[model samples]
Target chain A: MNALAARRRHPAAIAILLLLGLVAVGGAYSLLAPKQAQASVVSAGDINTGKSLFLANCATCHGMNAQGSAAGPTLVGVGAASVDFQVGTGRMPLAAPNVQAQRQDTSQFTQEQIANMAAWVASLAPGPAIPGAQYTSGQNADVAQGGEIFRINCAQCHNYAGSGGALSRGKYAPSLTGSSGKTIYEAMLTGPQSMPVFSDSNISAQNKNNIIAYLKTTQTEQQVGGMTLGNLGPVSEGMFIWIFGLGLMLGCAFWLGQKAA
Target chain B: MTDLDTTGQPSTDVVHLDEGHHIGTGGLPARFEDPGLPTHIHRMADDSPDAGRRAERQVVALFGLSMLATLVFIVAYFAIDKSVGIFLPGIGSTNALNVVLGVTMGISLFGIGAGAVHWAKTLMPDTEVVEERHPQASDAATRSAAVGIILGGGEQAQLGRRPMIKYALGGALGLFALPFVVQVAGSLGNPTKALAGLRSNLWDIAPGVSPIRLMRDPEMTPIKASDVTIGSVFHVMPETLKDSQHVLEDKGKAAVILMRLDPNQFSAAAGGQRAQAWGYQGIIAYSKICTHVGCPVGLYEQQTHHLLCPCHQSTYDATNNMEVIFGPAKRALPQLKITVDDAGYLVAPEGFHEPVGPSFWER
Candidate 1:
């Protein structure tokens, strides 16, 4: 006790104490931290194939080690979900460097190939994984609650109907009409392009499923009011009334005012 | 008729001609004669008895059709279910009840109108007639009498003789509007008091009290620092809002958008350092009300780090202390200085230094 009290005044004592404290915290955190669920299991062979494919296709923009270059951002910690959303949606391996990447109808890679790349990216660092089927499926979701959540969080950018809207500098929030349940989940998890992330911590898995269910219900629901005018809301409806409705009235007036033959 | 001179004055030289005289003899007609209406053309209903009978039958049929349509409308209104969906050829899906009600009502009205029109055009008189228009102004004697009556009424009131009463009445009538003006203006409230109210919001922590927790909007759940991840955005409100007298008004002023980004991503040239210092780690909070026109600036683009107001497209760089990068926003969004509490939940240690929302006169 006398030696310890004397050493406490030493110059290196504070540094030693801080280092010991950091080590203890790190060890405790590793043991106590919640485990990240692995949505899919990837083999050693899958990682090797993904590495080879990435080298041949992506090494030009991204460095051989997937480090960022002047042309592209680094994919070090951008998880498997990001890769799946980007590659699976055919938004990456970009056609050209524009304001934003456009989603293509068909992807360049198969599901297995995309999975392999996701595995390789996941191995690089701790990041979000592809969501499991239980969370991705919209079954047993509360559409009404999901609608409230969507309006608060998503309606500002994506529009009230999820029909997409324009952003600044040629960017846009894409429509969620035909997006698959898996794609929707991954997009929320990854936050591709201009979209902000809605991680599991921010929006729970069940809430996300509810949102998916609501979106799906919108696609299938009958438009009871007849013509939707492209579902672009009041602006389009107003313009239609101004043009067609007024034009028809004007035509009728002209016909009515004409002298009988 | 007299001819006008080039100077627009009536000339003394004038010539009048008889009714049958031609203008070739150098005489002007005294007046223009009115042209009579054209020869009447008779319709089949007017000339033939069978055609008249047929027209009468057609009118009766239209009236009968109107009665039938009214009956249909009443029956359909009671029979059709409100929830039943019907397919329209051009309009697609629609409510069966609405369509039926609208169509039946339209047909019933149309039948009556058409019946009345057909009865008038075919069976009733189709002859054209003219009626002369009378002069709009009153005669000089009548106008003079009206003016005299008004002047006599004014004299009877003693308005001219009683100077004191005249001026007093005038002043009373003129000043009578003051109360109304004052009431209306007072109802608008004091602008300075309103501006003072705007200066503080739900985030303002009272002295000697603990800092306010940042709760998730709508859900009102308390947020933890760990819950916010990189590129994730959260709609937040101060926990003090639970006790607010005017929840909507307080919420409008205190609503915030919280976002986390990579600390290194903040640009040094745009007040990014100060923004980072005010935040806890990379999680920063800013007033959601737009600096332009008080719109909710809710569109947060993660990669571009831009917060675009859906109204007016006022874009703010979220990483650069909410600096206006594009559109008409005049100033940066006010940042809320935040810190983590002992329980690791995000809390606002202090309210915004500047008034939030759009610029007002006092600001």
Candidate 2:
């Protein structure tokens, strides 16, 4: 090591080495810089457009300050992620309010309009924002590792395959099969509805990516059995076993008895 | 065997014979006729030598395949990585190791069954025999003979004559059951101690000790009062549980859910004044275990101030001192009384006054 330090005295070599180091740093910055930009982009939108849209469409129920009214719950602290989820999914500008907001066929607002509304609401109190573009990038995600993470963090409420299950009262863990990579990440970050927030402090960004990968993989590849029987698990499996297996056995016994007689 | 006559009635035509022995006069029938069985047909494998050889080879091949599949299963079990994915026709992608192991094991089991069925059908004996059915009831003389044989057996053994042997056998049989009885009795160890442990969990603190600190579960970090937000909920465990060997057992009893609500919304329901005073500010801690079947009650509706148990639809109103507002839970979730120490960290001043988790019949 001492001999190597004494040998490296060439000016040309030093310059070349410096250039290579600069290029490496530049390459890394280019690779990583877009993610930071994308996060800022999530929080950037026209505040005036957002306010005008809210007053015209939402203020009647949510109130002018968006602190909730008798008709609607407070949206003050609920943030951009909640707005993106509620409005992006077309569950917000509810047609005729009901027990629970249902997913609609098409979102009434455009993507730009949704972004503006999210920015306005987010500016009010500063809560959990929608997951940045890096979360949904889906690069270097290990599907198998994701399966393990999903089983631990999600399977209790959502079914083992992200098929969703009933929770307490009228609530249910919605299926992740239809959820986009962004939606699933945002839901984990923001904890929409009664779901508990799995913050970055709890589940890291990389772990969240793994979970999204697992969800996407499950959407394509589910149970490989001849028939799934609705994938309700034990209830369907037990019913099929009792009815089909017993019926076949009983038929065989009857046939054998007839032959004997 | 009685032969069926043309009139479909049984006729006695065969004579009974006992070689080198005289027949006892027990009033049994003297003669009966043999009832013929159906004729047997030879299979192709049995008739033809070449067919028989082919059948033998097929059975051998099946057994060989079975051995090969078993070897494959064993090799796959060790060599294949569980995470490796394989795309199968009609099945889509699945764990390669599981698929290989299942297929090989299934083939191994199926080969044995198929080989046995084929061997039985082609090579095994196919003979029909007719056995005569007699009256189910025995004659009075036969019954008496059976009783006499039993009596003869007793006399030969001389059990009645040997009092010592009789008593020894009786004692051995009686003592044989003691081990099982002792095991059952030992399993039900001092019910009072078990009940006391259930009633007073790890949070019960014990006498002359400082108040137990409330730590974040899994993280085991002490939580400050300022850390808790209005709508936020924390899954907490006692600091004493951090180094305990029985973490799961202790955590099951000691797990508490800490939630903060508006002070104006707090209502004194069942516990009244005492329950209201136990809370620190609007922040209160209640047993995480549901009163109905003891599921962890984690789901909280911040808007309604309802603590929901996932196992059952038991909703506890945290604002009303964690009263069971809905579902099958008849009793309220027990509240943990908490206070801040000089360090400004949350601590359990005293243990839960009432038993935590599902209620017993004695309660």
Candidate 3:
């Protein structure tokens, strides 16, 4: 009876052992593999097309090899993500260099052309890749968590309400109320202009989603207790109340006194 | 009362005052007319006994409603679950407790005001009397007369004689003033506790125990010295902060900005020696909070090594021990002394030597 029971359990135990072995082998392979092997797959955009696009649009400032010149900084390691964000948002191919680069309404290159140029620049050296389209989708966004994260990280430059505020010199954090999800996410990933880069390790994909959700909610929500007064905060609100609201009331009181007499 | 004619001329409405002639200016006409107030109209409650009684009952009912509303406010303060919400027609969902408290409090105040106003308009004295203006300073006889009138007025109002009114007014006034005092006293917590809270943050290094490792802000990952490249900045916090209950409060005081700068860039005159001794391989950490008003000093101009506070435009020179370069800051940001452990993780051997953040720490 004991021999029969042992033989029956042997097959089940062997199957479990085989599964564990397979997992261990896969884990080992992933750990031991070189980083370049994985990176090559992501950087496989057509080199010829990328080079031509870069030369036509970006070579005037970025140089023939996408290297640094007197006009602009090197695009060598800025990556496909940076190129997509800059050119895609019309912030690059800058309209005459000033204190800061401003976002324009029209893009000089098509989305495909921008991608090809970004690929060429990224081919020089491995860097951050373009985030997926679903990265900014409000599907799994958590507004409460996003609000907390935004307050911790972005509220310093962007106002609490995302109305944006002044930075050093002439540069300012642009308002997010009218910004699309792609613009907000791309801005965070790329840093663009004076803004600091928030890496995947720093914010994570889920955190970015949360921030986008929070921004959307803030944009949609109505300001309670009447006027927002430009959302510049209490100083402006106080001035309006004292100068306009109180002044009107005082004028009415004077008129009533004159009528009574 | 002044009445105008069809031709817009002043008529019987203009009445001359006897006192105006004596008070006339030397060069001007010795005549002046008194502009009297509008004629008084009697309310129904003032003339009819039944209407007066009805108005008195209505005032009592309003006061009763006010008392009931005050009871509701008191109950709502403690009994209601603050997080719950209620839905109403035409209006979206809102905090139930807030609505209840606000409505009850408003009605309580409004009832008192409305009751007092209604009493004055309908039941109180209706006759209109005018008094001539007099000089501010009074003679001895006039002062005595004023005191006598005041005493006589108190008797006429029957407030002094009515024990019920004296007790009711005393209770009402006394209770009405308590909420203000309670609000003030409750808001002001223990001063010593608050001061002590401000004195030290979450980074506590006990002797013989290992120092707290530096972790990245928000991410809370331990950082290695090799990770910091020259001209790069990392917003840092103490590793122990990960398990802290008061993460925000401690983070505010303990937040540090870690940066790696070239050793050659350090000027000899401005705390160069001290900075070199404290830092490990040109990597130094300073409190990110501004010395002016405790805003996060995040903006770093890499070329100038200047940390600027956008709130008030206060700037600090990071190259020379974070000296105040421009704007309102009175002192430098507090520096955190750090070193790498055996595992290559950056750790603080001890907490900040001085309290971090605003100039209030100096106190």
Best by TM-score: 1
Q: What is the C-alpha lDDT profile of model 1 across A4-115, one tens digit per residue? A: 7766787667889999999999999999986643233433328888888889887789788888899998999898888889987889888999999998776777777788
TM-score versus the correct structure, for each prediction: 0.76, 0.68, 0.61
Instruction: Report residue A229 deviation for candidate 2 (angstroms).
Output: 7.2
- Residue A201 alpha-carbon offset, candidate 1, angstroms: 1.1
What digit string (tens of lDDT, one per residue) describes model 1 on residues B20-71? 6534423444564555888888888988999899999998999899899899
Per candidate, the number of residue pairs that clash is: 0, 1, 2
Candidate 2 lDDT over residue span A1-261, tens digit each: 599978878756878999999999999998877431112234367888999999999999999989899998889988888888888777788777665676664577777888899889988998878778787755679888778767645676777888777755566777776777888877777766666666665556887888888878766663444345555689878998899989866865564343110
Instruction: Give residue B18's error in model 1 in angstroms.
Output: 48
Write one digit per residue (lDDT tens) for candidate 2, span B1-363.
223234444544444575555543333345545645666777778688998888888888788889999999999999998777777675566678877888899889867866766676677765666687989989999999999999999888998898899899999999999999999998998788878878878888768899999887655778787776565566788999967788789989998988776677777555534555787877789898898898888767665677777677898988787788898898888889988999989899889888888878676
For model 3, the superposed segments whose C-alpha errors exceed 4 Å read A1-50, A221-230, A239-244, A254-261, B1-130, B133-199, B224-234, B242-249, B259-283, B299-305, B360-363
Name the runs in model 2 displaced over 4 angstroms: A1-43, A64-67, A103-111, A133-156, A159-162, A177-185, A188-191, A196-233, A239-261, B1-83, B88-92, B100-132, B136-153, B268-276
Q: Which whole-number lDDT from 0 to 100 does residue B70 have in model 1? A: 90
Task: Rate residue A132 of model 1 by lDDT.
Answer: 82
Predicted structure with the largest lDDT when compared to the true one: 1
**After TM-score superposition, what is the CA distance of residue B32 in candidate 3 from its true location, in Å?**
10
How far is A238's C-alpha from truth in model 2 (Å)?
3.0
Contacts from the true interface found in each model, as a fraction, amount to 0.65, 0.04, 0.01
Error of 1 at B189 (Å): 2.6
| Lowest lDDT 10-residue stretch of candidate 2 chain A | A34-43
